[model samples]
Target: MAARVGLNGQAPRCDHIDLLPAVEPGLPECKECLALGQAWTLLLVCLTCGWVACSDDSPGGHAREHYRETDHPVVAALAPETAWRWCYVHGRIV
Candidate 1:
């Protein structure tokens, strides 16, 4: 499905995105990935409780693991300007 984009690639049509809490500031790195000597391409931050985990594409896929263990629901990209958030329950990026 094609998403509506505004002046800055905004997609207000994604109402679920509004319900997701913003990622807490800080948490610059995936502590587990670092400790395990694994490199991550992307990061997911738990909205319910601030926990940073590696993305599914990463070696360990800790982000998805976190959802499985905690069912926290949403996670926003760690990088600025990405403007992407995923809802595990819904299985889509909003």
Candidate 2:
């Protein structure tokens, strides 16, 4: 997969693209949300370690929290229809 490239055919503007896993893992639900007994609207997978967490719009906001704690940087939407990645450091879709 083209880990460094975005849908627009531009390389992501952050250094964390190099940290993506060879294969982004699939997960059924946001583990953090489940643990917190909260509901989530979107799921995101950490590109660095394949961590699954809820989007910022969710009550848990675990995906953004994970980045704040780990500095892992990149996360991709886990929904099959959303083929986009987000860079936490840059605060934009990569």
Compute the lDDT of residue 6 as modeled in candidate 2. Answer: 56
TM-score, each model? 0.72, 0.77
After superposing candidate 1, which stretches have Cα over 4 Å from the reference? 1-23
RMSD (Cα, Å) of model 1: 5.0
What is the Cα-based TM-score of model 2? 0.77
- For 3-68, candidate 2 gives per-residue lDDT tens digits of 565557775546677667676665768887787788999888888888888999998899899899
Clashes within 3 Å, all models in order = 0, 0
Candidate 1 overall lDDT versus native: 0.77
Model 2: C-alpha RMSD to truth?
4.8
